[model samples]
Target chain A: MAQGMEIRNLSAWYGSQQVLKEINLPVSPNQVTAIIGPSGCGKSTFVRTLNRLHEIIPGARVSGQVFLGEVDLYAPGVDPVSIRRRIGMVFQKPNPFPTMSIFENAAAGLRLNGVDKRRLAEQVEKSLKLAALWDEVSNRLGQSGAALSGGQQQRLCLARALAVSPEILLMDEPASALDPAATLKIEDLIRELKKEYTIIVVTHNMQQAARVADQTAFFLNGELVEYGPSSEIFTRPKDRRTEDYITGRFG
Target chain B: MLHSYPFRKLLNRAVTVLMLLAVVLALIPLFSILWHTFERGWPAISPTFFTHLPKPVGETGGGIANALAGTGLLILLASSIGVPFGLLVGIYLAEFNPGGLGTVVRFLNDVLTGIPSIVTGMFVYSLLVLTMGGFSALAGGVALGLIMIPTVTRSTEEMLKMVPTSLREASLALGATKTQTILRVVLPAAIPGILTGIMLAVARVAGETAPLLFTAFGNRFWSLRLDQPIAALPLQIFTYAISPYRDWQTQAWGAALVLVTLVLVLNIVARLVFHRDGR
Candidate 1:
């Protein structure tokens, strides 16, 4: 599992409006990297570009090199669907397939690939356990996933992504819609998930980034201001802008 | 009896009376039709009217069995074929295209919907009726189905459009393929709305008489074949109305009453479906 990613001079535009501009970063494998910036700073757009999902928007385009290992994801011959399969993502809010059963929710990816029943059952069980949701939901796998609580829905979404066995997980504020307890559980799950998968998280919560991320990247106006060990970035950032962000002076 | 300030109070009373009089004016036509139809129609409605075939122009005490069965079968055929195709086009316009193509398709559907029913019947008559060498139930069903398409398409699109963007974004974000997201997430949430659309389309097509007149020309016999002229309630009523026999005219009014009842029932069902979903 090659988990680290190298992005070079990435820029994104929505129609005539440019959101992300000239971003460069290298993320380490089996580590938690957090991108923290103010609202409308293009943090979400930057994260979505990693999984090639940003292009789903109309009149939206990305330019520059995004390399997942030696493969340039944006290369002319590269397939966006395959890239997405390998680099799975979760959104800020939980959105389970409302019509599907809880069991089916965790098995969507395998089913999409036309996997047989025996393998699908194995993947669903493994993914659910991996997300630490097996015990709470073991009895009612036949129930509609829309019936689950907000926190459980987020976990279900995580299990769904994990079922595909993706190498990299890009979450755009995964726990922002969750309550404090649910947020803590999700943050803890992220820490646990990073043991095997490369995790990239974008959040506005400075404290959250400090607590869970192994590395922190502070961005301003779509530019990377500073990237370093979490302790160093939060305690002693090299750039004055980074210091100002961590110290709550200004975004 | 008239005194000071009588002008102001009299004016207010006059407005109240005028409003009530307007309501009564509206009801008079409706009530008159209802009473007149029932008064003349009941004597024609008997077990024989449902079981036995209609008698000759001057005779009485027969049935409209063929017309009832024909109407039912034609509606079934038209709605079954038209509803599914309309739903697919609607989903495409809402989820898949959502661009210039979708816009053009929707505009065309709306334009087709606004076309008069008789024109649709006439067109189908000229095309299928002329080609097939005569009027047939198949021709009528084709025309009715054409009329149904626009209504189903418009309503289904409106319902599917009501689904929130966040729901779609969330599904896509989870690495779901576009097919999986639409089938599993979007369509299920929009099912009730789609059903209501189907009901509305059904009602619109069921009450259509002008289209069937040219396509399914009145047949006295209960014709089972789609390739031949067939019996329908509206066509039978037309046949009965022109006859010099008072009995035939009364039977026509009876068939008309039955047709109105079916449309009213369908409208109620459609409203109920919409109400359940809206709540």
Candidate 2:
């Protein structure tokens, strides 16, 4: 039942330093859209502004019109909390709630939304299964989240996001810190999740974008240079910048 | 390089020897105090030292049991008041960045930590003892609680600041409100450090004789009433140590041993708890 997202004429800044300048894009529902760029390219900031999280910093600001289906996310009286509930996020580093057990970390979002206590066990199990982490973690549900390996912790974070049943999932380089094996696992999980959720991933790995994304958008210096079907974007880019970055000439 | 190498090695050895000497010098007073307390206070220890009330001044065989009970009450009261207040101020400083107000509060807390214990006692005396028309356990606890606030606040702030920002972001990204993120993630992660602070504050105030000198004023009889004046270990030790009676001076040594042991045990327990939590 989730709808596509449409971002129009969006710009963002941290104090006087503009990070994202006049961006427009459309993300289809129930598909993976990968945003690729070098470091400091505003890829993370753009996604953060999508969920109104960029404003949390001391002097960060945004002027944007983001529509999730028919509702303008930045329109008057729109509560950022409510907007975020419908769009969950995962960060570059794996951060499972340090004090919570594996089971509790999965159930945190549900608990916050006042989900029934009796049903939490079932929900947590379902989320872990969806994240492909159940088999590894199910036996030791009471152990602290910190006890997990780096890769397992990232999957646990995925399970936590999925538990909330958000319409959209934003992953900011979810597998960047992981090993190749773990990275493949997350990529496979993303492929599976695209069936039920609209997903946007920000990554520095071109191969990862080629592997996981239905659509690919190339960014450089806070500007979106090209966005198209993954096949076209990789094989035949319209812009020189996109072509140059993709071809390993320069970043 | 060849010419300097031999001289550098000799210098390093000399420095190591000097550091070892410094360490031994620092440890001398610590070991000496422990030895003296154990030697002088050993005979005075008995079952009644912990279980019975203090005897009349000239009588030779009583204990500081009333003072022990009063100390327990005072610590409980002070901690109850100090912990929550300190934790909230620390949260404000760490989380809210309350601008100029936060700077003012931090400066004041540092100043409070520097103030003499007797001065804190006098302030409490003027504020509570004079206003309430008597020295009571409540006034003594208030003075100790005031002393506790600065240490607790500073430690809590430091602990909270140490919590990684990623955890807060993770919580917020999951649609948790700011308050929920802080309560569910930040505070829980910082618990070990905050608890260490609280334990240290409690230990710091436990041996304070000057603060209780004019506030609790000292009582001979067993009194549990918070409003009434109460006896405490430090007050009992100080009173007896200054008395002409040799038996009372002996009792003071016993009380000092008990007090030091209690504080040492508490610190050990706190360290154990924090270590376990950290893992």
Candidate 3:
């Protein structure tokens, strides 16, 4: 339950071109933190840096300190796969594995870590319920994940991320692709998820951040322009740029 | 103005006729050659021609049975040897080979694919025949497999590479090892394309006479041992086409017809696989 991520002087690069500048921020555990910024502001980059998602991109790299609770994620001898297991992600688009059934999709991460069948099955069930997808899909565990509707696919992705019982869950614009009703459902799911896993979401929708987030960080040009309680950040930001971004003046 | 419109319509008709004539020019010769080949080879196809051996000049008739069986076995052998390597090397190039090594390998594979089939035959002949001291079925198969590898490799790699990168990333992101990802996700997804490549390569190597001429050396009698001399369809055709025997020449046409049929079947199969899996 000691669940806050501390990021100190984080910088990242794609090939040789630096995409994220040095930054400092903290995400409190078991709480929802939203990162809001304009396009190419490194909002996504900052989230990916937490679990070293950028490592998978060839020629892309990070130079930073990311600590979840007591452990420094970027420390030598820390396996990326392990870090990711503890800090899961749901991408912007819902990408349930095309070949996997709903049950298999949720069980994938556990199987990767060599979990046994019974435990994996239980975990998949638990995570799907937690993601609010279990009731709808409980009877159809054998259905292909790709056969789900878009909102359902997003929830399946959430269920997949949750299956490993990760301490942190990173969602990149999880609801942006959803319709209004589905988006509200996701927002509600985020509220419910905050009771368990520490959540960090990046969204272009300021209203989404206002609805689900406890803390909000405004990023601009790879820099953290402001980080404060959502109420203050929305009502009385310290910086003109944060104000501009929040007001939808310009990215 | 209305009368001038008649001249415009005439120009359109003339252009349409010219285009139609051009299409006819392109298609006529292709069909004509096919027709002639069928005409010449059909005469060689009778029950006795299929069952018996090729006869001497001015004699009754015989079959290309030994050659047909030999060709089948040799190709089967070659495919057994080459297909797995093609699949593995292709997976390496598409899924794992990284840095400058992948580029280097891709370039080399392209070069190998471009090399003439006759040269591949000669190369294999030197390595398997002269060095080993005999022309055997095994030698023929290895030579054919070698010829097959690059063609199979390039096509297989291209087919696997065509699978969406997202599919690969999705597997990797699931924490699956590279090998696991390839085995369970990537390869299965590209199965049909890989099969098409294999079929095409098999068909291409089926009628190759140059390699077997040196490697198998064209046995007249049916032989089963890989180390012994072997007969093949292409070699029988090559031998009969050049021989003075009128009987051999006709049997050569018969062998050519069989070879064409085998190639055609392989091609049709490949086409069918592509059609079924294209979506």
How does candidate 3 score on lDDT? Answer: 0.85
Q: Which candidate gets the maximum TM-score versus the true structure? A: 2
Tens-place lDDT digits, model 1, residues B1-279: 766697879999999999999999999998888788778777777777787777766554788899988888788778877898898898899888678888788789989989999999999999999998999989988888889988888888888888887777766765567887788778888888788788777777876789998998868987868898888888888888887878888889888887777777877887787676453
Overall lDDT per candidate, in order of appearance: 0.86, 0.93, 0.85
Give each prediction's DockQ, rounded to 2 decimals: 0.35, 0.81, 0.35
Q: Compute the interface RMSD for candidate 2.
A: 0.8
Residue range A166-215, candidate 2, lDDT tens digits:
99999999999999999999999999999999999999999999999999
DockQ-wise, the better of 2 and 3 is 2
lDDT of 3 by residue, B1-279 (tens): 356888989999999999999999999997876676678888888987767766655777778778888888899999988898887788788777576998898788888877887787788778878878888998899888887888788878888888777666555555566777777777876888888999999998898888777788888786878888898988988888899877777777777877887898899999899778565
lDDT of 1 by residue, A1-251 (tens): 54699989999999988888899999999999999998888999999889888898889999999988889999999977778888878889887877679998898777777889998998899999998889989999999888889999999989998998988999999999999999999999999999899999999999999999999998888788889999999998899988888888976
Task: Tell the DockQ for candidate 3.
Answer: 0.35
Q: Judging by lDDT, tell me the better candidate of 1 and 2.
A: 2
TM-score of 2: 0.97
Off by over 4 Å in 1: B1-51, B170-176, B241-246, B268-279
Clashing pairs in 3: A3-A29, B52-B63
